[model samples]
Target: MKHFFKIVYCIAILCIADTSYAQRKTAVKAKTTTVNAGLKLPTGFHASIIARDLGVARHMAVNSKGDIYVKMDRVKNSGGIIELSNPADNGIARKKTVFGEYGGTGIAIKNGYLYASSNSNIYRYKLNADEQVEDTGKAELIVSGLLDRGQHNSKSIALDNDGNIYVNIGAYSNSCQEHDRENGSKGMDPCPILDSAGGIWQFKADKQNQTYGDGVRYATGTRNVVGLDWNNEINSLFVMQHGRDQIGTMFPQFYEAKYADEIPAEEMFLVKKGMNFGWPYCYYDPMQNKKLLAPEYGGDGKQVGRCAEMEKPVVAFPAHMAPDGLLFYTGNMFPEKYKNGAFIAFHGSWNRNVTGQEGYFVAFVPFKDGKPSGKWEVFANGFAGVSKIESTGDAKYRPCGLAQAPDGSLYVSDDNKGNIWRITYKGK
Candidate 1:
């Protein structure tokens, strides 16, 4: 009888051990099934999918009441801007509403108003006390009649605290070439496109029915600026310009295919009034760390030439990364290292051949006293969810916009999948 009882006791001990092991395995599987499983973030950061299938979600803004407004790159489901509300504070949104008629890539919330942009116009809608759009039909045109000849036509916008709105008017030409991207094509000196486009224009934020004539050309010579922000810390405007393309195809004599793939660096600049960044005239060489005259403008890949006087970039990223969104981090939920730093959503490179496609992720540039202080690091990745992509269509998600919520969570939007991800840090 003593031996029988001892055998029974051993069996019980084994059962308990097996059950505990099984429970641990189940818990780990549950974590892996969460929305953030595909995302790779910092040590304490976690991401949750707040909404999906919202239709070509581009740039987005978060209101004080935690409502999300996203601009679509195209008119999907008969609308352009979509709003998400989550009164329960859960990761999932309870109500989704779509409004606005124009599709674009910019959206913002400033001073009791929600601002969005189409390819050719900037529109503003007044927000109610609950921070929702009062009426989509009452949307006022803050600025209209900007150029939108299709190539580089996104009129991304940013607003300042001083009642000013900044709009990007992209140049239609690739490099203002006389023949437009043709080999041996010469550039048009005094590029006529700069007269009305290729620059940032400042206008009144509250003024309605204003045209391009009413706004002042704030700065000149940017090729195209999709990523722009008013840095409240520095009390100035900063812009990221999409560099000119097709170096080898146009000027193979001076540039090999490999060199063309990585010659010009995408630039971010602290744009000031009347500043010239030398588009259609110069391109920054990341390896040389110097501005060289463009091939169409009489450069042989080594000549600084007339581009010597052009303003240099504050920080230059790798070529073809296609930065589409810029936000200065002011939230406290993140670690102290991220305060006042710049977060850039690199919409990813589509034309890479030599180094393969890159930049479908979000990067962080540490800032000290309103200036970039360290090397830029990839903060969020796996939007593409693949190790390598042969083309842009292979990417699962292309990050297009970024916004910080009032409660300090960060929101990222994807134009490819129309998904919005909310990232938060829960570390104590």
Candidate 2:
């Protein structure tokens, strides 16, 4: 923790002020400086950055008091969770403080305590009445030493209303076995990884030192679910999966080059306990519009036989868009049409050899009750810039994180250039 605060002290200096009034005013002043979003808004729709210049800010959660907590990568332990509090009415906020050097990828606020995860482990940080980081000595490991494959390593987390914390343990390999793409890369019989990796585990949110060795697998066979959210309306957990990569690169006969950009759909899964979405062995095909068997298990591009018993996605999207954040709208942030919709941050794609850029935008999937009711739409754009190519290569600002403010406003984080944007709507 000593090394953790050394970097934070410099960030805190920019936020601290001599007086309370000054702090609040600064927040509001920052709100008015936003770049215009055309003259179409009725009035009062404002957008601005909360905090900027941080590496690879991924998942984020806000507290009851409206403080923002972000799980950033590489700030010691790959990255510790940082808190931003006292957001101004004008939309300006400050990086208040940070703790928990264990640096896991998931962070959330549930039942008065702050929960954070590091690769290989999970921890619970106790907070005081003000909701500031209070030293409960060191954080208790809620779950530890999970499957820590360097690929797809950021473990996203979500908590059910019933007090169960769900953590993602992604599959280490691309497609399970080599028979996957090559002429003959055979899958491990029974794929033991399905038992541990490529799954979501449930643990007692208030318990102590509960490592992966003791936790129960809540769901299985997902590739890497980076965006996990609990919708109290449905009383279930929802996750957006970062789908598998390179169908043709690894296996040309099974899939063509065009299929790389147009094949699998990044899935929006409504995760229930004991659910399994097949990975390494199966993929959701946007072209054929069904779940297809992966090439690894002696299956071709269109076979669903290998995934007969697996679960399917609630909503389907284009391939390789890389959804990094998922949030359901419940606040008055936009029109009534958006009240129950889900906003997803597509971190963009690298698979398309066809043409130009995609996924450098935030998308919205409307939900009525618990099901998707309408086609998804682009909620925000301009991240790709006016004209550009070379996705995953020449991105100056890629949308990587999404968080809904307490006021129904949405915040998007850019990983390439470390900027946080608050997007709000005032028109009907």
Candidate 3:
């Protein structure tokens, strides 16, 4: 009987050890699953769901207090700017507030003021000591009566340390065609659209009720710029120009479908005063690495023509990436290699039919002394969460905007589902 009891006791010990080991394995699996739950980031980087259901969240800005203010492409409950705050560092916003009555794609905080823009106007609200907007109803109109002729009028903004605000006025027509993208139609020479559109304008950040006439035309000949930033190191503006479209549709004899899909590269320009980027008359061709005369302007796809004299891009990217946000890293929390580099949010392409869809990711361009030093890299990807995205509708999340927090984390906003992801680096 004693020997029988001893055998039973040994069996019980074995059973308990096996169960404990199983439990530990289950815990480790749960942790692995949780860590990989968000968007796929660079190794050693983690992305967490910070805010969701923000109603078409666009560009955003982080305040000194670590609060986030995001602009909305669609008005939610009659509000536009969404403020998210989490003082506990819990990786999620414990409080959410909505303010402002306009919906648009520009938001930034500068020098005790919060700035935002609609399609045709720019406004500013005073910030209190807590780095929050004092009153949404007291928004001061900085500029009004901007040209908003329906297409590409996002009016994205960037601020300089010198009290100037830069706002983009995108071209209404794709290439200033005589009949608007019709085959066999010639381009309107001297492109009348450049008068009120196709460039960035400088306005006073503190001025009120200013019109287009009050602002100075800072840069010209950019097709349509949604992503722009002020590089303090260079003390100049940098803009991502969305390349023109429909080369095959408008001039099938000159361009094949594949060439049209990938010919003109999306350009990043170091925009300075009186700089012309050769819009309507020329475009940057990545294959040849030269400015080619646009098909609408009396040349084949390979002709440089007068385009040889236009200002060239600092660097060119693949065609139709639709960069909507550009940010220069100046935070100490990131690696030293990332300091002063540029992060661009490619909002994804809509018309790259031949090559499928591309550019639903954030890219990093290493900059040294305010110039691009190395090739661009894909920093944050997997936002679409699909093997292939043939159409824009097939994308689950389209990255539209990027913001860097005070603590050096990055914030990405999705317009498709209005989700905000905060990415932080915590590796050796």
**What C-alpha RMSD separates each model from the true structure?**
8.0, 11.6, 7.9
Using TM-score as the measure, name the better of candidate 1 and candidate 2.
Answer: 1
Ranking of models by lDDT: 3, 1, 2
lDDT at residue 189 of model 1 (Cα atoms) = 96
lDDT of 2 by residue, 1-428 (tens): 99889779866775574456697778656544445431112345556566777666766777767788877775743337667774656456777766656554677878777787777777777777867557744677777778887877877788888778998888877777744334456877578777678888888887877777667888888889888888888888899998887776767787767776676789999988888898877888876778888777666887789687889999888888889888888887688878878989888888766755578888898899999999988877666553565757776577877777777777777777667777777663
Query: Which candidate model has the greater lDDT, 2 or 3?
Result: 3
lDDT agreement with native, every candidate: 0.88, 0.76, 0.88
Predicted candidate 1 versus true structure: per-residue lDDT over 57-110, tens digit per residue: 889888988888889888877789888885327678654788888989889999
Q: Which stretches of candidate 1 lie over 4 Å from their true place?
A: 1-35
Candidate of highest lDDT: 3
Over 4 Å off, model 2: 1-45, 76-79, 178-184
TM-score of 3: 0.91
Which pairs clash in the backbone of model 3?
A: none
- Please write out the lDDT profile of model 3 over residues 158-236, one tens digit for every residue: 9999899999999998999988777778899999999999999999999999998899999889889989999999898
Model 3, stretches more than 4 Å misplaced?
Answer: 1-36
Clash pairs, candidate 1, are none
